[model samples]
Target: MVAREKLNQLKEKFGGAVQRADMPCNERLFVFVEASALKAVCQYLFRDLDARYVISIGMDDRPFSGKFMVAHDFAFDQDHLLCSVLTHLPADNPKVDSISDVVPAANWAEREIRDLVGIEPVGHRYLKRLVLPDGWPDGVHPLRKDFAWNQVPEGYDDTREFKFDEPPEGCTVVPFGPFHPTLDEPAHFRLYIEGEMVRGCEYRGFMVHRGIEKLAESVLTYNEIPMMAERICGICGCVHNVAYAQAVESAAAIKPPPRAEYIRTIMLEIERLHSHLLWVGLACHIVGFDTLFMQSWRIREPLMWIAEKISGNRKTYALCVIGGVRWDITAEVKGELRKVLDKLESEWTPVVAAVSKDKNIQKRTRGIGVADRALVKNAGLVGPVARSAGVNMDCRRDHPYAAYDRLDFDVITENGCDVWSRVLVRAKEVFESIKIIRQCLEKMEDGPLQLTIKDELPVGRIGLSSVEAPRGESHHFVITGENNRPRRWRVRAPTYQNLQAIPAMIKDQQLADMTISLGSIDPCFSCTDRMETIDLKSGATKVWTQEELLKLTRTKKT
Candidate 1:
């Protein structure tokens, strides 16, 4: 009914511009609008309706619809609805009005669409190459259906380099990474510093773009993607696994059994516990508080062990299938899990108390890397980053899935809007995760682990899923197609949005605080770089040296 009301509101305002709409359920709304009106509809939803911008998706639908498709997803958090405004573009010249001017959060996404899908965002002010490598040939869109998964486009200029923007007047450029002591993965940030203060920054990441989405749409089947999806992030792999399964289920109107839902809830919270503890430890280490770093990891180890016991792997649980989960919480595992939670809470409480009162840590982080409510709104920051700024948005609470609706817990928030605030939020959230897991263990009922799919999934139905990763919201978009694969599967990790705010967050801050400032959002470059490489040979694995790897990357040849 609420969805219908919103649909009616759109129809009333836009009339014929709102060509058609689909209300798959009370929680999901899909509106097809004229390509010309896409920008206005997005503005109305984002500004007037106060919908939170999630992500934008570009699809090459020429084989099926003979037209390209673009979708901009927004979350009406208060209404518990996720709405996507989609429009068709002419296949020959796929272009859509750029909404980045009005929706500042869509800047990188629009650029990425232009880069990978070759769908130009008309009137976009800064259309730099966001996802593609410098050596990748221009005008060869890899995501297009015509592009094969293994095809290497000719004319890849290995000697080509990225053209970075010039620094502001009187600022000295300092290169932070492609490799740095603080970074866990390869991300280059050219910091523009003026008198020990950061004036601005230019980020050149996606060094590990793996082409996983292309594989999903072209090569992988429905169930195979879950395994590959888990690899999206080393830490949050299970989050992607569950999110992908949920997306497919959502698009096909297939619900996982209740017991499987509870299992998913448990696994997700388990992931949260480990991720938060790991992040808190790393945050401390970044700020020179090695004591808490070691202590936090000490408390986190048991959770990983329990996860392995429950799902067989330490990190990638391989837990989800299309309709349900692959793992279950048996009685013995449940009892062990409860004991682990009890010990974890007992050990973690004092650490949090000490850290809260530690003046040294506070002094270092209190005002470092501030992302206020305005930054959150414009950048579409999520999870602890948004929560720290007093933005009450959580996918678990706002857009419930799995057994989160059945489980009751607090959404921890902080008003500091800085690195210190993020610390407090993630610290406090550990307790909430423990509470959620315990509730799942208690309330989980006996039922089938998977639903029986008697027929192939219906084609061309869109699915969107948002799972709250420890760092932020992990969103996935899916369009079911023939050959048991998705027509287009787009994953937007939390880091994709959170990392965009780094320039603003670090601006005007002390140059020395850059590492902790970057660490505060718990940036995961692996999640953001969702591409991959493959080896088809049956011989022993051949490890490439740095020189060899560089040559391979530049050439893009087998």
Candidate 2:
């Protein structure tokens, strides 16, 4: 169940290098390797074992282990094995050989760990600031346990600007955001353009980094973190809530009742339904198709109302607790949910058919923002983005958290590997979500909504959970501690990996199509920054009219 043969193979090859190996659950394997052998162990898992890199977490554990701790996570989607390769470095010399060269998706996580935990990623290509702001002072390392949550370092400069690399020869520099019509949050993009074609792009983002993880580890109690995790992403609040609860449950080895598991599954699917519909509408609006945008929104409004009716709030359901769910699907609510699913299916079928045949839609999307399987493997992309590229990996089917094991549904995939395929995948998945919810309603039995724990949860245990968010996989890693709080909590959002592939997708693309290319990912950032005006050196710097964008898109071929 824990891939015993593979674990033994690793032991056979790297016998002494594997300091400790554990099977925490049937699906998870935790291997603590010698600090010097970290790279080789990761390479074996990522390249030889064909495991997909999930995330890397850095923690200051000098107090407990007398050393710094780093965790490199990988997902063997085919074998359903989720592995964490952890290693500890000496407290005085807290450094580890970089694995980013072997696992490209580990690039940002390594840099982010360096930025927050003060553990240097030696040999990392871009070891500069990632999660921290440019104005943040050097050596401050806010995530270190010694630093207070609200503490501000001395000599901090709020007005400091990021310095990007020089643009290529014959290419003009075009700044995309800090203020752009398409991005909601304050992320700046430096686009090097030569005659309307994008040569390369450099991103300086994380303006939306709210320190949610810090809050959970420092101040929040065991039962309270679920509520805080929900605020991490506005669109996927329930996904965060559920992931956090499950991580705790996994660490404490707490099993909720069958009915609670079913409720969690139902809520997740409901969230997916609304999220996919919202994405369809937004993608349509990005392509200058206002009619479809309005239509999609019209069809989705009822879902928002239904969510509020059941969860007491529309977005932050706050439905998940440590051991189980806070709310259950009552008989009346179940009946209403079925009716809504029926109407959603009825309305979405015609829209999908019309969009599938629309020449304008196809031209705008067919060849744009393509992420091939090779790029996906390198960047460790997940969810629909990976599925669109013919990479068959779904956390629901592979990882099977919540009530997914008891349910039956297709893991929707597309071979097209383009924006068009991504759209189609989400559209078809709406029907699958409806199916999942219907099954939950039919097979779920009556039981308590939550479990009562007689004692405090065991401390110093590791917990990991990955939920299939509408955008992609949302993963949470937890380390339990004393005083009713987790000592360390790390969250890896889907955008953490998917956003890395943007430069690859947008390379050699027409400048006019940049908005749609970015929109295809459905970034959690706010609606584009209004740039009705721009500096004179760059002419015609205004959000394009619908007609112009569509015409520009059609002129370009795949």
Candidate 3:
């Protein structure tokens, strides 16, 4: 009913522009609008109706529909509705009005659409290549149906270099990474510094683009993608695994058993526990407080062990299938999980007490790397980043996927809107994750682990899923297709949006604060780089083919 109400509101304002609409369920709404009206409808939803901008997706639909498609997703959190606005463009020259001006959060997503799918976002200023390499040939969008997944453009030029922006007057440019000690992945940030204060930055990342989405659409099957999805981010693999599975299930109108939902929730929370603990430890380590860092990690070890006991791996759980989960929490594993959680809560309470009052840690983080409520809203930052700024949004509570609707837990919030606030928020959330897992253990009922599918999934159906990862909301968009794999699968990790706010967050801060400031978002560069290769000795560079890489991996194992 809420979805219908929102749809009615859109239809009332722009009758003919809203070409068609679908309400897959009470929680989801899909509206197909005229290509000309895409920006206006998005502006109305985002500015007037106050929907939260989620992500934008570009699709090459020429083979099936003889048209290109672009979709912009938004969330009506309080209304518990996820809505998508889609438009079809002419196949020959696919282009649509850009919504970046109105919805500032869509800036990178729009650029990504242009880079991967060749859908031009007309009137978009500052359109540089976002996802593709600097040397990638133009007019060769790999996401198109005709483009082979393994095909390299004929004019591929690895020797080409990226062009960065000029530094502000009186500011000196300083390169931060691609290999900084604080960063675990490869992301390069060129910071403009005036004395000790940071003026602005230019970020050039995606050094290891995995091309997982292309692989899913072109190669992997429906059930097989869950395994591959887990590798999207080393830290939040299960989050992706579950989110991908849920997206497919949603498109097909299939629901897993109640027990499976609980299992998913439990695994997700277990992941939260380890992730929060790891973040807190790393945050302390970044601030030069190794005592707390060591203590936090020592307390976190058992959670990993318990996770390994429940599933097979500590990090990549490989837990979800299309309709349900791969692993169930038996009574033995459930009891062990409870004991681990109990110990974690007890150990974490004292650390929180100590950190809350520690003047040194407070001095370092307080009022540093600040992202106020306005930045959170404008940039579409989610999870702890948004909550730290006093924006009361948690996908588990707001969107209510899996067993979240049946469970009870608090959505933590803080007003500091700084690195200190984020530390406190994540530290305190550990107890909440403990609470959620306990509830799952007690309330979980005995049922089948998966739903049985009798026939092929209906084609051309679109599904969107948002799972609250420890760092932020992990969103997945799936369009069902004929070959038992997705026609298109787009993953918008929280980092994709959260990292965009980095330049703003670190701006005007001391140069020394950059590491902690960037760390506060808990950015997973791999997730953003979802769209890799190499050479050695002779200094001759050659992009390794998948076959060569697999052979190397096999040789190493042998």
Candidate 4:
């Protein structure tokens, strides 16, 4: 009765879009709310009930409903796992109110949503395209159901003629990517700066939109989509696959064997280790520590090798499938993992010590993008970014899935709430992940890795699954019970949550600090791009194009 009362309060406060509520196999109950109530519920969950923002995601809902869904994963005590606040908005309109006002971490999430899903966040102070080309079409949202796969929009082939030289008066706009020098991927950013500080910004992406969501609907079966989804992000591929499979399983109401759960957790932690290592390297590079970046990546080689050895592919390992995992680590591989963990533990000490003690790194990172605790909670941030801001949230610890509940590790947090704190949190989490892998190795029991789930999905059922990705939270929403595949599939990556907090973080920071501040969110632009609009009423124009405006000063010497 006492437990029920607590759950009831949560339901009462955030009820409108609460879709499905359930206790896990354990007795603790959690309710799923709408994305509209995300900020309110997160506040209720945290300030009032002491819950934490575990993670959030924005998924592409293709075909059937043709809507994009936002899922915010939250948690309370160790026992209770709040499923998510799941809300769906039209793929055409795509826009939703920005939650950054409430949770600072959401800045990046909103940016990515604009970048990938073409969602125009109403009132989002920094609604720039994050990951796509500079001259993407105005009304063609990429993740929408109707976006043509084979044909590129007419003007996309020749966007070189549409560059803008100077931004409007008092609004300092600077273009970022879509093939600039900053990043490997084709994500673009146009910063609106006020002197040395950033006033607001925009992000663009989707230069390489493979139409994975649309392809998933046409080509893949329910079982095959898991492997297909694994290719979404090369770094966090496994999490995408696992979360999608789990969502399918939840919709079907089928649980994998206990041993399979243990194996899944092991893979997840291994992936976590490699991801953190990769990010550490990137973080180093961002601060001009190329040697450290290379060294960290070198250490990550063993984990990648092990992943290939076990799952056949080095990057996109199709280890996870619906109903169960596709591969299992043999005793030999298990032994090798333990050896790798031991090696990483020994090697990481000096590496981390070097970074932590470096005066240069300290100068570059310390106090450089501070998001206070109030901003964090209000924005409802997630993952290490939130943890760095004193939000002790980790999906593995809070909303335990797979064998996370069985494993033991602390959710690392730091009060520093700066770029330095974020780096520290991720570094500590790598160690915690190592501990988890060791536990899984010791406790492994021989069992079948695969389960036979029917190809067809049942009708009228919706299942949401959330996983802590390297950046933050990745969510999969499956609304399909009929036919061979999901009728509606929505996938939300962590960038969706982190993108929202950018404007808040970069407001007063120097322009140079903008790079580091953006990196603090740990964004992924696998598929994001710029989108522009012209205000019909005012006749003032806002268009995202690379078109070069005529410079009056550069005009013929009159």
lDDT of each: 0.93, 0.86, 0.92, 0.70
Error of 3 at 148 (Å): 0.4
Residue-level lDDT of model 1, residues 1-558, one tens digit each, is 879999999998899999999998999999999999999999999988888999999999999989999999999989999999999999997899999998899999999999889999998999989888787888999999998999888887767878999999999999999899889999999999999999999999988888999999989999999999999999999999999999999999999999999999999999999999999999999989898899899899999999999999889999999999898888999999999999999999988898899999999999899999998998899999999999998999999999999989999889999999999999999999999998998899999999888899999999999999999999999999999999999999999999999999999989999999999999899999887433222224443465577787899566
Question: How does candidate 4 fare on TM-score?
Answer: 0.77
Displacement of the residue 10 alpha carbon in candidate 3, Å: 0.9
Error of 1 at 56 (Å): 0.5
Ordered by lDDT, highest first, the candidates read: 1, 3, 2, 4
TM-score of 1: 0.96
Q: Model 4: per-residue lDDT, tens digit, 409-500? A: 88888999899999998988888888888888888777777776554556756666778887777767676645577755667677655665
RMSD of each: 4.2, 7.5, 2.8, 8.5
Error (Å) of candidate 2 at residue 489 is: 0.7
Q: Number of clashing residue pairs in every model?
A: 4, 4, 1, 56
- Which ranges of candidate 2 are over 4 A from the true structure? 525-558
The lDDT of model 4 is 0.70
Off by over 4 Å in 4: 1-7, 10-79, 83-171, 527-558
Cα shift from native, residue 388, model 2 (Å): 0.6
* Candidate 3 structure quality by residue, lDDT tens digits, 1-558: 999999999999999999999998999999999999999999999999999999999999999999999999999999999999999999998888999999999999999999889999998998999888888888988888998988878887768889999999999999999899999999999999999999999999988787899999999999999999999999999999999999999999999999999999999998988899999999999999999999999999998998888898888999999888888788888778878887888888888998899999999999999999889888999999999999999999889999999988999999999999999999999989988988888999999998888899999899999999999999999999978999999999999999999999999999999999999999899998997421112233334465577788789554
